[model samples]
Target: MPRKRPGRVRTKNTNRREALKLSTMAPEDYNVRPGEVKSIACPNCRTWRRIMGETVLKIREHCISDKVADGEKHVTCPGSNQVVIIDIDVSHWQARQNRLLRDAMPQENRRAARQFYKPLPAPAAPVARIHAGVTLETARRAYLAHVEECVRCGTGQHCTRGGALAHRYVLVRKEELARRKAHKQSAPAARKALWDQRGGATVETANNQCRPRLDGAVSEYRGPQVPSKPLRVIA
Candidate 1:
């Protein structure tokens, strides 16, 4: 029989401890210092073994799951071998820190530091409300929408605002109709004028010639006019 082999060792779970540490960590603790190499807790492993280099001063190298001397198995951190970009502008960060520091200081100290900027004063009187720009179609649609709801509303018949809106909508519709009618009438006249300019017979001359012919044919159709009422009544 073959000799029995040792089973693979399992890694310890330090998630709870890492969670506690994360809960207590301050905002400033995450800020990486310029020109300094530091070790931080690995995001995947939750262990303080991830090294941040000073050359780029950002996380470029991933965590390696190395075994401890006790022959225990280390958990395979998923973030291993993944390239991480930790680009932080030091000058902008320092400027933000300085601004925060200034804001936290007393007014007297701030006055000694530099001249403070003041915001513009608000206007004295409240500005009147201005109507938003809208097209004629949009205006007509809005008035119609109000009119539709106003009929079913509890206000019943005394809805003056709805009435006014409806009146305005009707006037708009009338104007639109007038515009369409004028366009229709002008189109034929325009075509006739263009045809006459191109040496064709004018529409007016054609109508004048046709009028007498039509009247004569109508007169020739009937023998004579017969009186509907009594001749005695006429006498």
Candidate 2:
């Protein structure tokens, strides 16, 4: 007969009774660390015990039911180490772990932390050219600035581009003057229309009636005089 090779002996029996209990088990009851041994609330002992090995599948093989001291007799847990089939939500577990890790970080550390980012390419230099359909105000400002800077841009005379820009500026000023004149002419009629809409005549009559009554009250009423009795102090 060949000599029996020495090896680690298995402890704790994964009997049928313990395996049946896992059917009603929830994910919360088990503490899972990815790439590490998983621990669960022992159904038999009602204490946290580690499931055997890094691989969670094939869990029916064995489990560490309870912690044993040197020379102490191992108490076998009623929970089954055998009778396989365990479901693990890997994504949910990873998300939960990440949340916990974030929460554990210090406020200062977390605040300083930045996501990985590639620096944006620098913006291209703006094109140097006159803008199309420039507004009157913009043209006026540019014309004034150009005349102040350039010696050639005098009262009537201007550079080639300046001549075209100056014409646009003059046109804008003329249009603005026309608009202001039209608005001034229409303003009194607009105000009268708004006043009529609000029944201004009735409001004015109410105000006139209130003013006379208020004047009469003001004329009759004298402000309160100082109290006559001044020597009344209780002991």
**RMSD to the hidden true structure, all candidates:** 22.9, 16.0
What tens digits encode model 2's per-residue C-alpha lDDT throughout 131-227? Answer: 4556667878887877787677865579766676677688777877898999999999999999999998998898787445644333345533544
The estimated TM-scores of all candidates read 0.25, 0.32
Q: Least lDDT summed over 10 consecutive residues: which range in candidate 2?
A: 53-62
Local distance difference test, each candidate = 0.51, 0.60
What lDDT is reached at residue 160 by model 2?
Answer: 66
How many residue pairs clash per model? Answer: 0, 4
How many Å off is the CA of 60 in candidate 1?
Answer: 76
Query: Candidate 1: how large is its RMSD?
Result: 22.9
Pairs that collide, model 1: none
